[model samples]
Target: MAETYPVLQEAEPFYFEGNDIGILVIHGFTGSTQSMRDLGEAYAKEGYTVCGPRLKGHGTHYYEMEQTTYADWIASVEEGYQWLKERCQTIFVTGLSMGGTLTLYMAENHPDIQAIIPINAAIDIPDMAALQNERETRFLDAIGSDIKKPYVRELAYDKTPVKSVKEIVMLMEKVRNGLHKIQCPALIFVSTEDHVVPPGNSQMIFDNISSRQKRLVQLDNSYHVATLDNDKELIIEETLRFIKRS
Candidate 1:
């Protein structure tokens, strides 16, 4: 990273209710806690300790992430793990996109997680990876550094580093390699027609996870970012049920 990590202030105040229920809602790639704000508030209103930490190298200068690796991203989630330990007796973690990959990583590594919910979670990139030709496209741009940019919205910022995309792909590989290790209850949410990460990504997790109580939900009217779409409320309700059961 180009600059030292800033001590980001918490997005929402901690609601200290007596309820021991808790949730850690993680956002998608290049997204901040803002994307999960509504869902976080829904859980918080129910007196759950909802912690949504901005992943490393996100919600800031994208160029600063040129050197950042997926390891840094996982470290950010680890910090959230420590923060939530004392807040609730049982903790549920849920994430979107790359966030979902990290959630599986956590659930696989940390057996103590009460339950896990991955919304439009991406794992096993080669199955249905993002971008048509991301590696070649990114490499050409990097070599020239003067090539006309492609993509939209994100390209409006500093173009995604080729290395960063590779790192995310590596993250997917790591998560896929450890999929069967996740024995905890899992609620996998997927959009039937996700433009970013396809539904196969979710199925990969559902197929590999050993959780007997696991489930998969196909969301319509939503693309890649289901956490912010109309089906979010259903996700919230179903997740609450899964957490209670587990």
Candidate 2:
């Protein structure tokens, strides 16, 4: 027997029409476009076309994610990129957690990407050995909603599929190996108190990437889900500045 979960309305994908500069906003693993909506809207308000794509198998149910692979997630973002490429002259990519990882992956592959902003991206999973040993467990406790803000929770799955975790691990390895291939200007954000991804992961990305114009900004007042946390405004302001300058 398999588990069943309902689709969340708030997790649907979003697109906003604006200027010729397009922004592709991606959400974290186990999370939907809801997590990145505020950031995308901020860009849209500033006259940048924004598209927030709901990754395949996400925003629906964890059981559905079990049926997906990292390739499927990549295809989802690639489609969004193509959509923006057709409408805009310049394109920027940004994402959170696994979304951030995929952002880096895109920059590595797409030399023409104007710039990149990866927030709290995951490079290494600390509990990989333990997770691999859990052969009997098909699911684990949710890793979503690690926000510090009160009365706010991330719209994400309540459970994490073990197989999906493995898929992300594979994606992380591929991205990690290709870090030096990324030459686009980058603005990397790391939450000092992130409970999901180790803060050191950001440092590793900063050190490994070949971007000459890369910066690491530390969020002192947020958790893993900084996009929806107390420092959300800072992330938006700095990102807007980065986009303008880049």
Candidate 3:
């Protein structure tokens, strides 16, 4: 028999049905749905239906991540979106890091997405061209768990697969190029002290997107994983306000 492993409590997916306005939350590249749990729950409490899907190869072993690509992750998001679409009259998408990138991609391709919230969305990373050229190694140091809050760790693979990193780089380029297609209102958050993603990523999105109704908020106290850091409450409040006004 093949070996099986139980999913960690924090890594499990979460769904809460509440109201007609549904929210689809997406986590980072190697990170699990736990990263988005608090935000999803907050939105759910506000009488909005919410779903956070475990991305392909995440919430599992690192080797499994090597077998997946960005397309697989996007497919997972699409599945969650379809699930929410069936039950809700309107839908919004939110994400952190690569999750943010996926959020923008969905907004571009899916015209019906009511609004988008992308925090610390990855666009261009440092030396991404060289990283894509790497072939000798299959993995690199993990960049997913970059939270600055002490004792609070983001659940992710110890090592990031180079293949997956390349996939993310490709996804960033694709999303960046297609920013013009994203017409929905967007509320972007950029953490100034982010250790993993450069602040320029958020700036790139803000500058390139054709959305006339867009705003950028800078987070001074948090790191890349701002959803779980010091400014988490601020994010929650701002997102709620944005949803109401949108």
Q: How do all models score by TM-score? A: 0.83, 0.97, 0.96
For candidate 1, report its TM-score: 0.83
For candidate 2, give the lDDT of residue 129.
29
Model 3 regions lying over 4 Å from their true place? 1-6
Candidate that scores best on lDDT: 2
Superposition error at 22 for model 2 (Å): 0.6
Q: For model 1, what is the error of residue 132's alpha carbon versus the real structure, in angstroms, after optimal superposition? A: 13
Q: Count the backbone clashes (under 3 Å) in each candidate.
A: 0, 0, 0
lDDT string, candidate 2, 198-234, tens digits:
9999999999999999999999999999999999999
The list of candidate 2 runs beyond 4 A from truth reads 1-6
Residue 185, candidate 1: Cα error in Å is 0.7
lDDT values for all models: 0.73, 0.94, 0.91
The true-versus-predicted C-alpha distance at residue 1 of model 2, in Å, is 15
* lDDT pick, better of 1 and 2: 2
Report how far off residue 244 is in candidate 2 (Å): 0.4
